[model samples]
Target: MSSAKYHQIKDHILTQIRSGQWQEFQRVPSENQLAQQFAVSRMTARRALSELTDAGILTRTQGLGSFVASFKSQSSLLEIRNIADEVRERNHSYSCAPVTLESIDAVAPIAIALGVEPGEQVYHSVLVHFENDAPLQVEERFVNPELAPNYLQQDFHTLTPHEYLSQVAPLTEARHTVEAITPNQQMCTWLNLYNEEPCLQVIRRTWSQRGIVSFARLVSPGSKYRLGGHLTFTKRS
Candidate 1:
């Protein structure tokens, strides 16, 4: 089948879901139904459904059928709101201590994350976040200059990188990973953590309309911070 036909089928289904024609966990049309409706082969219809399933917008079962995935299932750590906002929401004062802010040559790993060539000049910033004068998180970030040209000139003391980037570029997607490790000497000093204290490290990559926007590593002392959020789940009938 032509790629356009399959994509059209996919877009139709996505429109239904987005338009609220399909609710969470509601079964979508079977492949046969879609094929008949779109005048495409069952294989083509299946390809569209398969792609949506892989994208986490739908779920498929062998005996049943494809259904709209639960909203919680599509949730990602990258979707978490800005840290400064989170702190203020808890009625605490938030401040950012600038540690490093400059343009640097991207290394291989940074290049891979930003989808840029190695040695390309990128804007880098490091800030230790504080809540009421006690350090809480170390935010190390690199920005794609192509996406946010004035990244280096931002007054982070008054506005966070997260806030700045959101204004400059519209976010399209985000990726996140979490790990646990002991704080290094630099991290220990910044976060007021002991060397043996484990830290929750969250690495995030964000994309804007242009392309990859920024890559960030956030470290919080495990004893002082924990990641928590409430997710609504549909009860099965």
Candidate 2:
């Protein structure tokens, strides 16, 4: 199968899903169907679907055919978590690449979030997290220098900021604000998302013994990741 033809198959599936033409858990065209439609061999069609499946865009069962995966990955809004641990728990391979790491003068909204004055210097870092080699999350964070000194020195690829922060200043409290967002081009590129795909954003502020430690914006393609938790209520009568 030429790359173009296979890419066409993959692109068709992706387009349907992103355009809401196909709903979650809906079964997609079978290998034979795709083979006939694209005039390609069954092997080629199967490979196309396999690629999507590996990318967390589809789920294939033994007897049943492939269906769009359900909110492929998840995170808890109630607790601060190490993304690496979350991915490992799902039995998926996890990796990360730090895009930006440097010191910057705090600006308005971020300064307020980190409780630092506007001219004060703070550590700023941006990274992308991957699951099974597919980009899953874009993490942009600002750290209070007073709280986590040497913030820009650590290797984020090996030790995520979440993990390093935990070791330096165990989380004592946290706040999370989540919303749906339209990602900018750069963020879309980082998450390997189409421009029209919806994204979930979590603006988080974490505190430790020292005070507000970090403020982070965590964004992921809505199709590939989700955020929620199980909660139980007691009778209050």
Candidate 3:
């Protein structure tokens, strides 16, 4: 059968599963049966099934048939403006745990990122962002003490870092670089990511009118979170 026929049959099967026609843990139609129904070869039907199974949408058992896999994670790539607001907008619960909030001396790399002199004291915070009780992202940040004084006294659990920063210091400009990376031992334990699974890492630096206010390293499970940027072009005459 043609690839078009295979796609059609695959989509039909997916729709059935998604629409609750084939409930979870229920066996999907066999390859031969699906081929007969779609008037295609068994090879074409098998290919569709194999691809879907690889995608984590279907589970196939030897001597049995395919079943729908649960734990479907929804991911969206968006800027880190207000994670709590975004999650609530999507009707998903959002929460955070401030792991460490303290004042620390900036090292060479961190000083450069924060646009500060090396050995300068800065406010540091480690936070874990969550969606519906599942840990989603880990944020390790260093803030300019001049911009955010007495930062450690404030409670981040009640107010997110983004919210507090926006209230005190409106962001003037932001820079970001994203990459796929392997999780370290600490990250694996926090994000619950397997060793072989790739995680998305975003390095962001935000500047206020005063100067660079903060530099943050954001790490999220690739399977559960996605980062995205939006842009609009302007014409110059």
Candidate 4:
């Protein structure tokens, strides 16, 4: 079969899945049925389904036929929002204190997150965000130098790192992991917390069209901060 025929078959299946005609975990037509409908050989139909399965759009079982893959749940914390804007929107005064901003050699962990080699120079910044004179968040971010060449030159106090990076390289994707931890001595001092105080930590990695944009560790005193969002769940039809 011609490559175009296989792709056409793939596109047809994709259109059905994308349009919600085929719901998550809903069984798809077998290769024989697809071949008969598309007037193609089983190999051609199988190629289409195999490609979709490889791309995470479909799942196939040993005895069962292909089915639409379930979409992964996403947290609103992964959504790109300016921290300064969030504070201001709460009807409180917002301020940022730039604690550290410099070009540094990426450590192993930083390099792995940024998809760069260790010892490569990367832009690093630490800023404390305040709401109504109270420290609300401590942001420690490592930026890919290729994506934001002059990241260190920006005045984070005036324009937040998020704001600046958004202008330079529009975010394409972001991944976040949240956890609770006891604040370290330095973190406590920065956030004005007592010893053994728990904090909510958000570790986020973001990407742009160019490549990995930044990896950030944002910490907030648990007593003063909470993360909440709503997600709609859809049932298979």
Candidate 5:
């Protein structure tokens, strides 16, 4: 099928934002104005606006229209399972849609995450995690070629990265860090985020018995995914 009108309009707005033409927290044009400018249906304009809102690029409220949001931050606490699994344990339905998967040479960031030399070979995958049909997270990940030779051969729609890795590589050690990520236009569109809603980005490196297994960067709606744990101090003699 041809590209959707909303997607085209969304891309245009994102281009403006990336070009610095649309400053942070600034109000975008009204839906009617955008529709007229784009020569699209009002519903099409609405779709574009909705897409931005889901991507955390813009915030929308009842009768308030839409406004841009600042860059988001990523946050993570000690957690062992996928954020989807965490939400599911609370009785909510969690699902994922695998978008793209391919083998590629590792870039600098991927190499760093996988603890490999830059330009090394790796397997890359992009998946969107959803909670009850609403886009919740975007997972961009790389796998060590030596560890997961057939990474792209498996069916990710039926098995999550955590699940697949657990079966093949069984985690032995891991390092996880969190930070804020101001997503690009594509990421925002995939996650259905708003510009105003910052996102939580979790960077995880995992090892198996042999060596580095996988490195994954997980991005999610900050409002939906939160980590909490209780701590206690022990007395020493």
Candidate 6:
């Protein structure tokens, strides 16, 4: 079958979801059904579904079927995760808008956090993340250029800062401080939160073999996101 056949199938499915013809948790047609309806091979239909599932438009259950994804988004408090991955795994589309990326002179606070001289230049970035076209989080970061020199040149729309840094400087130690606060207006605008809405913020600092790699402030609006973690205890031998 032509590549256009699979793309046509994907576009149909997306249109159905977007138009509310297929609601969240509603089961999408099986590959066999789609193949028959589209007059294409099952392989083509399967490709469409698999691509949609990988893109987080649909969630599939083994032995069951694929369903339109729901709105809830979640992440782990105890682990450092690529927010893009976190969004997709929850059956939600992930997108990012890069608001700022530049080399800026570090102020006293940024300098202290990065363990650099107060006037040293640091790579800074601000990004707003989206889940299913709705704003989810705002990530503001400062990178130590010595650790990741190309931080400023990265295309954040293609890959998140977390993903890029993990590649260049594998994490050795990470510190997280999570708190609830009322975000400033600019942050509220970034996350699409109302002025009075509360936010969950995590102040994260990561280290590599040499020294600190980055300092970041990750903030999510209270109503639209969640953070959790799980651990299994093992008896020591």
TM-score of each: 0.65, 0.65, 0.64, 0.66, 0.63, 0.65
Residue pairs with clashing backbones, model 1: none
Q: Pick the candidate with the highest TM-score.
A: 4
List per-prediction Cα lDDT, in the order shown: 0.81, 0.81, 0.76, 0.82, 0.74, 0.82
Q: Scored by Cα lDDT, where does model 6 land?
A: 0.82
- Residues forming the 10-long window of minimal summed lDDT in candidate 1: 70-79
* Tens-digit per-residue lDDT, 1-237, candidate 6: 548888889878877866679998999999999999999998999989976664445778889999986533223248777999988999989999999999999764466567787689999999999999899999889999999999988899989999999999988777665667788788877877657798898777788888888888888988887778778779999
lDDT, candidate 4, 1-237, per-residue tens: 558888888878866865679898999999999889888999999988976664445777879889886543333344567888898899999999999999999754466567787689999899999999999999999999999998988877789998989999988777666777788789999999866888998877777778888888899999888887656679999
Error of 1 at 63 (Å): 32
Per-residue error for 203 in candidate 6, Å, reads 0.3
Which regions of candidate 1 are displaced past 4 Å? Answer: 1-78, 232-237
Candidate no. 1 TM-score: 0.65
Candidate 6 root-mean-square deviation in Å: 20.6
Q: How much is 195 displaced in model 1, in angstroms? A: 4.4
For model 3, the run of ten residues with the poorest summed lDDT: 69-78
Worst 10 residues of 6 by lDDT: 69-78
Give model 2's clash tally: 0
Give lDDT tens digits, candidate 2, residues 125-194.
9999999999999999989999889889999888999998988877887766576778889988898876
What CA RMSD would you report for each candidate? 13.1, 14.9, 18.6, 14.7, 11.3, 20.6
Model 2 whole-model lDDT (C-alpha atoms): 0.81
* Over 4 Å off, model 4: 1-77, 234-236
